[model samples]
Target: MDTATLQHRFQTLLEQHRKIVFKVANTYCRHGEDRRDVSQEICAQLWKAFPDYDEQRAFSTWMYRIALNVAISFVRSNIQRERHAIELDESIDIAIDDSTRVHETDENVRALQAFIEQQDPLHRALLLLYLEERSYRNIAEILGISETNVATKINRLKQRIREHIA
Candidate 1:
């Protein structure tokens, strides 16, 4: 595809799957600045990989693969470099309507975020993608695991979170 067509396709895909970017960012980085940086990095990676996109596969699946890979790799490298300490207390303010009804929801999300932050980068990516309502097949594909393994791991992760919060 030409540069213009590629850019246009990427723009549309980004528009549609932007939330995936944010969720991946939030999972990997606790601070707003870091989240924004990670999101930008993921977008850059996606743009770079756009030219190689195979039309036969689902676009969301392909996008998820690239975004998750970028986020996971970034987190791993940051950990290895020991660049900065991760603070779980940092709030990721996701815009939500019905402010009055958000207290409990926010609390739950914050608790889950904290728990996920404590996990290794791969597990954090898995749980975050699961929370985003991605299918087991997609999760397996993104993580390069079997669908059954994704289901099993998510079940265990859910139990662990429930126990932690309880």
Candidate 2:
């Protein structure tokens, strides 16, 4: 394919699945600045890897794989930086609090988000995709796991959520 054609195709796919990108960024980042940074990084990585994408495969699945990887890396780097900051400022009490927090749609959504936030990164991704109504095959493909494994893990996650909710 020509350069223009490939670029157009990528752009179309991105427009169609842009929510996947935002969802990933929001799921991983607690701060607005961090979310914007993560979203930009995911878009950059997606553009970089678009040329090599296999057209036969599902576009959202491929996009999810890339977005998830970038988001997970961002989380890892953030964790490292936070650890370093804590070590460096063990005695400091810097309180530059902001009162500009955005409200969620409702209490139930906020509660669910809080619960998911407490999960490990992988499990968090799994739950996010599952709640988004991804099929077992698509979730497996996005997560690079077997369909059976996806089903099993989702079952366990559902049980855990039920227990917590109860």
Q: Who wins the lDDT comparison?
A: 2
lDDT of 1 by residue, 71-152 (tens): 7787777875544456545333454332422332466766776687789877887887786687899889888899999888
Please report, as a residue range, the 10-residue window in candidate 2 with the lowest summed lDDT: 87-96
lDDT of 2 by residue, 1-166 (tens): 8999988988999999998888887777766678799899999999999989998998899999999999999887778665212121123222212333434544554556667877878898999899878899999989899999999988998888777766
The TM-score, computed over Cα atoms with residue i paired to residue i, of candidate 2 is 0.82
Q: What residue runs in model 2 are displaced by over 4 Å at the alpha carbon?
A: 81-107
lDDT of 1 at 60: 78
Superposed by TM-score, candidate 2 places the C-alpha of residue 3 at a distance from the truth, in angstroms, of 2.1
Give each model a TM-score.
0.84, 0.82
